[model samples]
Target: MPETTPRGLAGLAFGGDYNPEQWPERVWDEDVRLMREAGVTMVSVGIFSWALLEPAPGTYDFGWLDRNLDLLHANGVRVDLGTPTVVPPAWFYRAHPEALPVAADGVRLEFGSRGAICHSNADYRAAAANITTRLAERYADHPALAMWHVHNEYGVPVSACYCDSCAAHFRRWLAREYGTVEAVNEAWGTAFWGQRYSCLEEINPPRRAATVGNPAQALDYRRFADATMRENFTAERDILHRLSPGVPVTTNFMTALSQCDSVDYWAWGRETDLVTNDHYLITDGRRTHVNLAMAADLTRSVAGGAPWLLLEHSTSGVNWQPRNPAKTPGQMARNSLAHVARGSEGAMFFQWRQSRRGAEKFHSAMVPHGGTDTRVWREVTELGAAVEALAPVGGTRTEADVAVLWDWQSWWAQNLDWRPSEDHDARERADAYYEALYDHHLTVDFAHPEADLSDHPLVVVPALYLMTEAAGRNLREYVENGGTLVVSYFSGIVDEHDAVHEGPHPGALRDVLGLTVEEFSPLLPGERVRLSGPGGAGLDADVWTEFVVPRGAETVWTYADGPAAGRPAVTRHRLGRGTAWYVSTRPGAEGLAALLGQAVEDAGITPRADLPRDVEVVRRTGESGTFLFVINHTAADTEVPLDTPGTELLTGERAAGRLAVPAGAVRVVRLGG
Candidate 1:
């Protein structure tokens, strides 16, 4: 797929989320026996066994882990060793009492939750630093260690902090960010609530869910919390640099998770040796496919387009969500390819062996019901064999001229402040933007704030609510330098401070897009508006319907409902040599698909040609060859026809021109680059 990580394993490591730590000596033998039965080659260990790793504080224990490491390496399997920092031990919390987090409702955390480290607390940082340093020193040169797994999922905390450390840090962060308290007060518009603080110590996060009508400290608290967690990550990474300089380290990032601290994928990507993430979906397949693709895409884009480790996925199915669903007979096979079809090189599950007891006891695993011989094990073997068959084509890179900019800081900024419209989740919008491109066969590269767009032929920034002046300037140069630009609704509504723009909704893009959004209408489920299309046929609309007028841009599509009908719901303007398309509404899949198709077509983007919709396609470029992965998500059997002739990698299913794609199956096609 896209060369998300050039410095990755030789081929996709086919197994993940192993807890050899959870099993006994006999069970380890059983796991290895089963692993050999399958072609399983890699394992991610030491995720949440803090209690086991450190039975007691200050005294390190490596006996159980040493044996565990020796076994994996002996079995010819590489291990992604997790640093037991995900959950601090029971004794550490008991001793240094201030490590707990203060909830958003201002409740001081008792030792009740799992990820309980207070980000801004010095005691917590020093203790965490010491533990990581020690752990790295112990395991840096281990034969089985492929990557260092840092703390799990650092999402923006749900509840704000009231602790003195967080407060002081917030004051310092604000002071450096805005210069003085007066600028902050002005930006937050604190005069309305009489909540202005005389001293920084008096400031506190919202205890209750504050209304959007009243500007609360919740948004800033969320930012500060994310920032603080970042500080923690940097601290640990710096410590690891001293202990394990060669072993690349990273934490598993949950794509849409809000509870852990993340301003954007790139926020941690900078510190991480290699970005690794998890993609779990129990939702509807139609939409969930995009969700999976997006998770992979985000992972690929985070480290400036480096392929990420597909750390954890349910080999069979997931145990969370409204329903803990298992993958259908052919679903697991299809899902594995789905990751590959969207730029992922490796695939792994949450648990290689099933848990006998605990919360994830019901989670699917490769080692099924009765030890060594089972249907799950058979399927695992088959999938592993597939990876081995296609091994020569792995670790390739993809450079799409289309770059889709996605930022986590913008997500936090948008959801933090009060707005007059519907509640919009930043992650969902980001997914929608990415999916729009994917639906049209556009292999989109995820663009972070610092991403260089010069390599891309097109750049689409959807719902960019946190565009700093530099980011805006980047867009301007990209468009002026001949890149097709697309910006969706709520574009340029706010400055970097989460404050509104002065003249119009799209504050920064007036120079590039040549238009300003005066007013917009919130679209509920069925409500929609249409814009004039090719044959006077209008574009479909739903979600967010925006009203727009051009300063110099030309209208491509117009809204069909309310007083704002016929206005520019979609507008295009010529800037320098390239073009910009501003879509001011959250049009449904059809509309988004069409818009992306047209934008790419206009920009001279030659897609994989006319491939089937159910069959997802991806291309990875290497010095020797170009690899194309075609996956059929359909439940019915089908044949695959190629637009460009290529050699089949997996099935030897020749495509001297023609290839067959079985129902719920996949084929990895190779061509000379």
Candidate 2:
């Protein structure tokens, strides 16, 4: 495995995306000076600079890039050099219009925006390879180069293309996956509605249809799109590796966002040398910190518990949201440190300097539009100092006792057109469980359902709708081997092809859960059912309900009032020395927390610390020592009881007993060697 730490960096990597090509040459000197003053150590360059790198077809421009790289090296700032392939130059697309992607409605998308080229387009692939090869060959041994950032966000604007090239590519991919049309028919359940194809050529990308499209076809198309993206990423990565041997390569992942659904990070993680992510806060009354923590945890898990990078986040308000609220006073610092608390060894942003023009003009950067005197720049400098102060955090690994199952295939199939409830979003369900664990100050790591669960004391699978036979067997083995398994409603209902299981509703897990569901009772919008359990522990269940019949599992919670009144809403089954718990309804936060608390107790798992609500704690162990990060996300001052003894890295003061963390602030306590 590639080491999580950046190769030559002395401390935690601190800086943001730097674009010297946007400004005049004189401004480049001033930017480097400012970066050093702010304690910036690294900057990502050449992102979205395809037009500048190659102004015309087969033409290259490296004079300006060479000057900037030399200047940054002289100023002691390392570089994460990007390939500038996210957006192809306009002239190439003008010459080969076939490279433009076609939308689901068959409208050919133009070349004005980024990610406009179809991944399967032969012309686009060739052009991308040519440019990447040139870049790697030119900068193979550059002293300033620290890492290779291959392409910007992959599936952002244009995830799937419906053009002829993509259709052909999709058929070819299906052939590779299924081997024959008959096998495809069996896997896709093409016999339904007489949708079976006689030949491989009949299949196409999931374009718009008169009625609902085939779910199996749509699922396969999603798989194909991800595979194409991975292939594209690997092509660039291979060029970089072959040319610049030891340099780490990565593509920034848009974690926990809607765009993340298109690619499988677990598979992508294997290709990249380092795992990195770009997460912007969703400011619509959602718990932005929770989302950030979730993204960081998932990124760390994808990196195999190694420290990852926070490739992008806004210093203030983002321009994209309907109402992009600016981060108050210390919110930016708090947000950045929250990522560090989880597993990120670096804290970076979208851009180093604010854009003077373009779509992202209003997006916050390290240096705001208002020069160095502004609050954004001041906060950026302070964050840079904080990151520099906590230099020992580099290469540290966050220890997680709980593993939450996150599967992209399950996520895709769960949200398919025909489901139990329209509101049954897979991520939201997973977040609900994750939030419950977060509420308990427990460190959590995301795990694929098929991943080994023996390492984690507690495994929570929320809304795993499409459970494969392998995954089902893995869960059974996990539970039978003394692991605690918690599964929610609508899980293990089908195989990989979106075909329902023959027996029980949660077909594959029925034996492990020791229960069978007679029918699914999906509640209407605003409709809810009451659930009651031991000691009058009650909560409202909404969205979905399963009429579960227990065979050998003991009832933990029952429906108090509904069509399935008195039915087991929650059941626990003991398999050998282990236990499996099933949740048949969408329980409210309090109820879910209570149930998870019971599971945590039963599994003999301990939290890092008992923290107040809205306060987060994470423990990272390394060669240096164990570092505990306590963050207060609330708007008021809070005190946390800390038993570990060590010096606080942020202030270089002794930390023990109780520590006061101000509102929107973080505390990094280095607990003993």
Candidate 3:
């Protein structure tokens, strides 16, 4: 086996999760043979094999793991060794029942699956650290070691705990944050509902209450839970860094999915050597490829535009969806290339081989239940070849002129009980904005509110209800320093502690936006207000509506017919050579497209190429040259016009002027000398 550099795997890693521990010793040989045939460069091992690695407490058994590592090394496959702290052995729970987490309703959650241990438990942390130390010591000098997978997806099953230990930890965390009981009360606005606490022990996790719980307290608890998970990850990561020097360490992130709301990837990215993410298709919506591109873009931004890894994705239909429909003929290849187009150095799936019996038996893998003769295996092999051909794209960066803000704290605050509308879903709102940009064939990157904004010409913030003072200052500075900003409805209404800002609605941003909201008139379900803008653009606004009186901003659009008719539905204010546009209502897809399109043109931003409808185009640049990825996501074939002449790596043909991209296909062209 050939070991890769300490930074990462040598070439584009084209392998998936390989659980050789689940099979017989004889099967390992067959797996390795197939790996070579499929061009697998790396494999993630021991993700959920804690019980097998350490059968008993303070006891170690490495004979099986040693054999598997040797076999993989002999087969020329690099290893992404997992610490196996995601799943605790049953004996662990039996010996230390105190490690179990309690639900919001005070019900002790029994562990029958992985990731059920409380993140704040002392025993669990100690045990996890011990295993990580042992693994790092044993594999530090191994020939096949490529990277260290710190832990499986954090906060997947159980994000927070309400146990006594966790409660105490929460009090200490709050004390460290607020300093005193009076400060905690002031931050939470506890005096409003006579819920003020005089001592640290009086506080606890947000449990069920008679009515809606305190929004500020709930927001703090969400932050505490995310921090606790980060603490757990850092503990193990520190041990690995000390024991195994020069080995890159990372934990897979679930980007933009529901499970990711509890953990902040913006903060987590600072701790990882390289960022990686697992994105599954949303079968119910049938727009899986679009969502995959969005996730990839966000993941790349989290890595600061560095090439990251696509750790997990389904080959075809996933078993978790209500209706698992397998991918169409060329859908698999299109899906994988989409990630690589957006700066992913590697393309990988959830598992290598299909499980015979388990919860994921129906889930598609590289080698499906039908074996290598099936279409799944054929597509997997073809994808491997395509990835190998795209080795030039490795270590490249994707360029985007626009950025959309993503904040977990705002997500928590917006969804908190007692809001303007029950349909205030943070993920859906952000996706709608991203989808509009994607439809226009414009590249985008996800930006944290507090991150540097000078790189992007235009920044779009959708439904950022809770804004920290620093984040608010950053946005203001961005606008004042000549950066265009687009803020949708229900943004900047509160500060970091979920406290409403004084003065007008949209609190801290009232000055920058040059508008004030007097009242909120939420629409009933299935109700909408007609909006008409300049240049014959019109659409219906649903979910929420705010009556805005512009003080300095000029009206760009107004409500046509509704209770809030003749009012400003959209406005734009110019400050310091930059523009700040605000949408006062939830505009439908067409309206958003029209408004965003105008914003792009106004900011002097140009798309990489003028693509046809449903055709996605992105550019990646490196020392070699610029690579243009044109993917036709539609069902019908389309001809994409390329501005620069270059060789198409997939077909070895010199392409220029116009290239025909087949339906559900992709073409990678290396442009420039």
Candidate 4:
């Protein structure tokens, strides 16, 4: 909406969060100097400096931030100025204790960490607005101000607060959404638990009860909490937009992280002028690069297929994970370029200088505790040069070969209590499907279910338990229009109200899939099932199985031996000129690969089957020309099939026909450049 990317940057945006207040005033000079040496063009300042910026109510201290910005501008470094509203100062919290968030158990969260304020509290909103206005008034035209970063990572640590203020706010939100208490009762299915409300005032925030609360109410509360945070963001954003008309405003998003799930990124993506995300690796015995690529692709899609920035990633290990492991040599560059390969304007880290005394002190940074002589510093400088060399690829967008349906609302709805089985995880299904597509060398673009799907010939729905009527119609029409669709288990079961769709199981997708599941036969823990299809094809599945009765679909695979033995486990239907595939059980990796491979073929899409496993190839196209990125995440040297002759950006090597990608190395080719 603003410019599609961060403005006022000469090349690609490259830098990290800079906290000059954390260091002594004397270190400011050295910080900018090192930034220049590392090819840093921008730094986000004052994100958590609320306590320092406003020591007392209405008291102001901008001298330190002014000096820091001036010095960075003098050193040719741009600033992504923060509103410093994520955390209120001690005095403000002391004065307005009602601003503190209350747990679902009715215990008030003390003001000791970040994001402790209740979003519904008027005091916090007023304080946040005041600080934002003051900052906008002071630096609307500052030379170094390139972007306005709003409150840091909304819905992190604290999303919903069960305080009385929130209860009232929830009622008001319900009033606006449903318009009447009868409507709320109907939507919430209050007849079951005798929980019908007489009026909006009787409703609460789904606090602790004897048993599981109303899932419909729980779902609405999640939406309410997300909307409350968004309301605050837009309030601050409107101020910045009014004061600073052209400067793009953004709030770093953790779109792909499991820990931060309350915020619906699709809604937030529309609100931000420029979409940016902060991604950290989980390091949980999986391929971290795949997760990184997934995050980057998701962020780029959130930017509406435009170029987005990587606001925060680690140089090595992060401190918060249960097992923090350092990245091996060259792994950092590979991780960053993998994101670039998908579609990131540039690579940036959490902080420029690592913290010495803070909750995140053990977290890695560009300048680690060991400083410039360390391996991190050396790699940081190398990555800087690499990012600078690929400036021509900045505005270019990565073209996706396939589209994956991703909706946070469905994820939220599916995660509520009293589901089919605990083993059915929405995110896990998404990851499995994404990883399969990645292995097929298919670049993916995530789309909301109701979004236009005509452009993507192949659309995948890994897991979507909650589907709106419009989304169902969209999918049905897409299949009828000759677009191939692949859907996994536990999808299209419920509506927005957490109620099963009327008439049949598999609800909205019943017609499109040409099948209906009468009953879900979830397997016992540690149990597995085998499926046999035509031509003697065999697959192993676990976690779930279903008794699928075909309306018009052909059974491709049947449960060979399980609780639902002889039942259809996988089916295919011919709709219009297109095809729709239904998978009713969770298959192993190899089985999934085989099924997706067939679907890819049905969609008339060609994957890079020539590339070795774990090797990635992505292309970016724009006015600067087409650039092909070949990233090898394996341990052996491999060559990617390339027809066009071009100069490699990373090594300046001339290549034609085929490109050599060494083990753990990244190669960027400016095609015919």
Which number leads on lDDT? 4
Write one digit per residue (lDDT tens) for candidate 2, span 1-673: 4444565788888899998878999899899999998999999999888899899988899999999999999999999999988898888888999988899999998877788868998888888889999999999899998899999888888778999999899988988999999999998888889899999999888888988889988998988898998899999888888888888999999868875688888898888888999999888797889888999999999888888999898899999889998989999888999899888888988889999988999998998889999988888888889999988888888988789998888888887786767877778888899999988888789988788888888899988998888898999899899899999998999888989988877898998999999999988889899988898878898888878999899998899988799899999999988999999988889889989998998788875455678898788888988998888888889887877778888888887888888887899999863
Q: lDDT of candidate 4 vs native?
A: 0.92
| CA lDDT, candidate 4, residue 245 | 81
Model 1 misplaced stretches (Cα beyond 4 Å)? 1-10, 156-160, 186-192, 195-199, 206-217, 256-263, 423-426, 523-526, 530-534, 607-609, 637-646
**TM-score of every prediction relative to native:** 0.91, 0.98, 0.97, 0.99
44-136, model 1: which lDDT tens digit per residue?
Answer: 787777777677876777788898889888888887777666577888888877768776566777764567677777876776787787778
Clashes of 4: 0
lDDT values for all models: 0.72, 0.88, 0.87, 0.92
Estimate, for each residue in 222-292, the C-alpha lDDT of model 4 and write its tens digit.
99999999999999999999998889999999999998999999999999988899999888988888898
How good is model 1 by TM-score? 0.91
The residue-by-residue lDDT of candidate 3 on 147-167, one tens digit each, is 999889998978999888999
Of the pair 2 and 3, which is ahead by lDDT? 2
lDDT of 1 at 635: 74
Model 2, CA-based lDDT = 0.88
- How does candidate 3 fare on TM-score? 0.97
Ranking by lDDT: 4, 2, 3, 1
Q: Which 10 consecutive positions of candidate 1 have the poorest summed lDDT?
A: 1-10
Instruction: Give the count of colliding residue pairs in each prediction.
Output: 19, 0, 0, 0
